[model samples]
Target: MDKRINDLKKMYMDIKIPDNIDSIIDEGVKKGEIKMKNKFKGNLIKGISSIAAVFLIFTVSINASSAFANSISDVPVIGKLVQVLQFTGNKAQGGQVTDGVDIGMISLRKAKNSEEVIIKFNKSQDNIAPCYSISYEKYPYSMIFTVSGVRKFSAEKDFEALKQSNFISDSYNIITLDDSAVRFAINFKKPVKYEVKEYKEPAQIVLSLKECEKGNDKAAYIVRTASYPQGETLGILEERLCGFENIRIVKDDKGTFAVEAGTFESEEKAKERIKEIMNKCGSDIKLYIEKREANQLPKQMQ
Candidate 1:
C-alpha cells in the first residue's frame, strides 16, 4: 500500500501546470457575469414596457367607456383614480352611441359642504353642437337639465353615484327623450338653487348646487367693478383686487359675474364705494351698482 501511494504522488507531481490558467479562468468568469447582467437588464426593460402598455390600455378603456368608469369607481383601492379618468375624452365611442353627441362620464365632485355635478361632452367632433337648457319644477322639487344631441347611455353611467351623495336626494335620474336628447331630472331633498357654467378645453358643464338659504330678504346694494359671464370662476381675480374691502364675487340673473366690493343698504353708499374702487383701480375701470336680493349677507373680509 505504501509503495502504491508513493507511485501516485510521483505521477501527480509529474503533470505540467499552465502559467496563464488563473488569468484564463478570471476572464471566462467575467464574461459570464456580464452576459448574465445584460440578460437581467433586458428582462427588466421588457417587463416595465409590458406594464406600461397594460396601464395605457386600462386608461383608454376608462376614457372610451362610461360603464367601465363607473365600474372602476366602485372599487375600494383604485377609487381615487376615477376622479381623473372620469374627465378624460370619450370621443372615440365608435358605432353604438347616439347619432349626434358622445357624452363623457358624469362625476359628482363633493367638497366639505358643497357638491358640483359635472357632465362632460366629447367636443372632439366640431360638427356636433353641445347645447343644454335648465328648468325648475316644484312639488317634488326637481332641477330639469336637458341636454340636446345625446342619448340614454351617453353619460348616465353614474346616476347611482349622484344618489350616493349626501348633498343630493334619491331618484335622481336621466330620461331619454324622443328628440335626440337626455334630461337629467335631479331631485333634491329640499328646494335648491343651482348655478350652471360652461367650460372649454375638455368641454364640460358644471352644476353648482346650493341649498336654499332661508332667513330674511333685504335690499343689499352691490358695487360691481367688472362684468364677467355668470358662473365664471374667480381665478386670480381676487389677487388682482387685493387691497380692496368687502371683496367678493357675485352672479346676477343677467348671467354675469361681477366683483362686488362693500355691501350697502342704499344706492348712495354704493356710489361712494364705486368712487373708492375707481380711485384704487384704473380710472377707466367699468363700475356699476346692482342690488342683490337679500339672503344672509355674504361674509365680508377686508
Candidate 2:
C-alpha cells in the first residue's frame, strides 16, 4: 500500500505540460489514464477534498476574468477603446485627445524628446489634432502641431506650413527676434533724388552722390513719367549727362572723373531744362525721369 501511494505521488508530481508540446500531448494522454485509475483507488474523503479545491480555484479564476472584461467594456467610446489598448496594457501619461476619426491603436516606440513625440503623432493620419499634444515633464513649455482633418496632397503653402518650419513657435517659451535694427548696403547705377513732400508744402530733398559731380555745361531737357527699357536707358543716361545745365567735371579722392550738373534754384526750372534737352535728343534715347532742383541741388547750393 505504501508503494502504491509513492507511485501515485510520483505520477502527480511528474505529469506536467512539456516545453515540447508534441511530447507533452503524448504524456498527457498517458497520464490521463493513470490519473483515472488513481481516482478510483484513492480514499473517498481525500478525493472529494482535492476535487473541491480545484472547483474553488476554477470559480475564482472565472470571476476574476469576468471582472476584467467588464472593466474594459465600461470605456466611453470606440476612440477610447483604441486609446486604452494603444500601448497594449501599458498606460500613456500626458497622451492627447484628437478630433477626427480614429482607425485603431498604433504602437509608439520610445522617444527621447518632445520633437520625437510630435513626429510620432504626425505620422498617424486623421484625428491626430485632438489625440496628441507634447509636453516635457521637467520643462515648463508644451510643444505640438495639430491637423484639423484628413490632409489631401497638394503643392500649396498650406502643406508647407504644416512642417516644423518655425522651431521657436513650436516651443512654448519663445524669444522674439527684432529684425527692425537690421541694415544693408544698397547700390544704384543711376543717380536717385529723395524728397519728403507734405502735400503742397516745400519738399525736403536728399541728392544721390552722383548728382554732385560737374562736367558738361549744356542745359538738360527732362520729360515726366517716361518708362525706359534696359536696352534704351543707356542712351538716355548719356544724353542727360551731356545736355545737363551748368555741367561740371569733378575729381574724386581716387582720381576718377565725374560729370555733374545744375545748381538750379527750383525743381520745376531744372525739370523744364531737362524736358527741353529730351526734345532735342529724340525718342530713341529712353528717358526714365527728371528730379527737382531741390533733390539735385548740391549741399553747397542748398
Candidate 3:
C-alpha cells in the first residue's frame, strides 16, 4: 500500500478498526498472498488509510497470549514470515514467545543542514514493525514508542550512537516490557511535530522530526477563485466576486489579474471558505489554494 503514510504518528490511533481482528489479519495475509501470485497487478491501494486500517489489528492484539503473539509474529507478508528466519530467531525458551524481526540497527542523527531529527529502524525484513504505537505528549514534551510481538532487541552498540545527535533531549529510556514486547520513551529538545514513514525492500521505519515554531502557521492559504488577463475588462467576473471577504484583484508583473478570497493560516478555515465559494459560485469557477508566506503575498502580487 502506498501514498506515503497515514497520519501520522500513530497509525492505529486515528483509523477505525473492525471488531474482528482475527478475520482482518487473515484477510491481510490472504491478500498479501494474492499480491504475490499476481506478479504484475496494476491497480494498487487507492487510499493510505486502508493499510492503516489493516495495521490496527496489531495494536489490538498486543496483550494476546504468548502463543497467539507467536502466531501474529508469523503473520505472513507475501509467502514468508515477517521476520528473516535465517538472521532472527524466536527467543522463547520453553513457553510461547512471539517471533519477531531482530533489530538490525537503530540510527539516530540530525539532517545535514536542517534541525530535523531522523530515527530509523533497520529490521531483518521490510515490514520490520509488528504491533506498535507512537504517542506524543506535553508537560516536558516527549514522544513514546512501543511495539509488541518482538523477537529480540539488538545489543546497545548502535543505540549509543544516538548521543551524537543534538536534535532530541539526548536521554531516551528503553524498557523491556517483556520477552515479546519493548518500549522506548524519548523527549525532544523542544516541542516537535513528527511523521512516520515505512519502506520495504530492506525493511525500514523512518521517523522524521521537525521542531515546532512558537506559532505554527502551517500555511497561508489563498483560494484563487478567478483569474483574468491584466488589461481585460471584468464584465461578468465582478458579479461572481461579490459577498467574499478580503476580496482583492491582485495584479502581478506577468500581466494577469487574480481574484483571491481570504488569507487564512489555518488550513481548515481556508478549506471551509473554498467549499462555500464553490457552492455559491457554482462548479464552473476554478478554485485552488496557493500557499505563500504571510508577508510575501503583497510583495509578489501588487
Candidate 4:
C-alpha cells in the first residue's frame, strides 16, 4: 500500500502545470462575482422602481376620481359610477348610490292660448319613486325648482328642443346640487305665480305658471279635499277622481298636493259647486280661491 501511494504521488507531480493558472483562476472568479453582484443590484433597482410607479399611479387615480365625478355626475347610466365612489348616502333601486335624490328630464310649453306656461317633468323613464320632495324658490325673474333625492336628468328630445322655444323669455338651466339633487331654473320675463301637479302611473310633474294678478280679485276657484304629501296621496286622489271629468290634482305654492274638484271664474260659482263635490266625495272638501292672472286659468276653465 505504501509503494502504491508513492507511485501515485510521483505520477501527479510529473503532470505539467499550466503557466499563471492560479492567478488566471482567481481573476476569473473575481470577475464572475462582480458580474453577479451587478446583475443582482440592477434587478433590485428595477423592482423598486416598478413598485413606486404603480403606487404613484394608484394614488393619482383615487385623487382624480372626485373631480371627474363632479363634471359628469349628472349624466345618466355612466353617472352612477361617480355616485358609487363619492356618494355615501341613500341608494336608488339599481344600486345607484345618491344623496337621496334623482332628477330627470324637464320640459316647458306655452298653453294653447299663450297665456300660461306649463313645465312638465318626463320623470317616468327615470327610476324615481313616487312623491319625492319637490320645492321651488321664487326669484326676481326665475322660478327655481329644487328636487331632492334625484341623482341625474335624462333629457327628452322634445324637452331639449323646448329650451330654445319662443315661450321662454329667457333661457332655463338645469344645475346639479349634489350627488342626489338638482335645480331647474325656469327663467321668465316677469314674476309669476305657479302651481304644481303630480301624476302616478306615468310619474310626471307639472308646473303651471301665470302672471301675477292685480287687485283683491282671486284668479280662480278650486275645491280641495285635503293637502297631502306628493306621492301616494296624489295617486289615490287621481284614482278616486278618475271617473269624474274636469277634476284634477293640483299643488299649491307650498308643495301640497290637493284635489282640485273644479275651477270657476267666480268665487260664488266655486262655492256652489263645493256642496255638490262634498256630496260626491264626502264632506271633507274645502274651497280654494286662487288669485291667478286672467290668462292663468286652467285649460278647461279658460
Candidate 3 yields a Cα-based lDDT of 0.52
Cα error of candidate 4 at position 153, Å: 9.0
Question: What ranking of all candidate models by TM-score puts the best one first?
Answer: 1, 3, 4, 2
lDDT of 2 by residue, 140-188 (tens): 0111122222132121222223333221211111111211111111122
Q: How much is the lDDT of residue 33 in candidate 3?
A: 92
lDDT of each: 0.58, 0.31, 0.52, 0.48
Stretches of model 2 off by over 4 angstroms after superposition? 1-232, 235-241, 245-264, 283-302
Model 3 TM-score on a 0 to 1 scale: 0.35
Provide the lowest-lDDT 10-residue window in model 2: 197-206
Candidate 1 lDDT over 205-240, as tens digits, reads 666777677534366777666655433244245445
How well is each residue in 39-111 modelled by candidate 4, as lDDT tens digits? 9999999999999998888677646765334324423321111111121121111222324333444554444
- Which has the better TM-score: candidate 1, or candidate 2? 1
Q: Can you tell me which runs of candidate 1 are displaced by over 4 Å?
A: 1-99, 127-129, 171-179, 214-302
Residue 196 local lDDT, model 1:
60
1-302 in candidate 3: lDDT tens per residue?
Answer: 34435545367586887689989899999999998766444334435556777677666665555434644553442132233212112111111223565555666535433332333333443444455555554323455555566666663355466666564654343433256665555555566656655445445445566756753334477766445663334324544766886554453225355666767776788889989988888877666677755323322332
TM-score-better candidate, 2 vs 3? 3
How well does candidate 3 score on lDDT at residue 70? Answer: 46
Better of 2 and 3 by lDDT: 3
TM-score on alpha carbons, each prediction: 0.36, 0.16, 0.35, 0.31
**lDDT at residue 247 of model 2 (Cα atoms):** 34
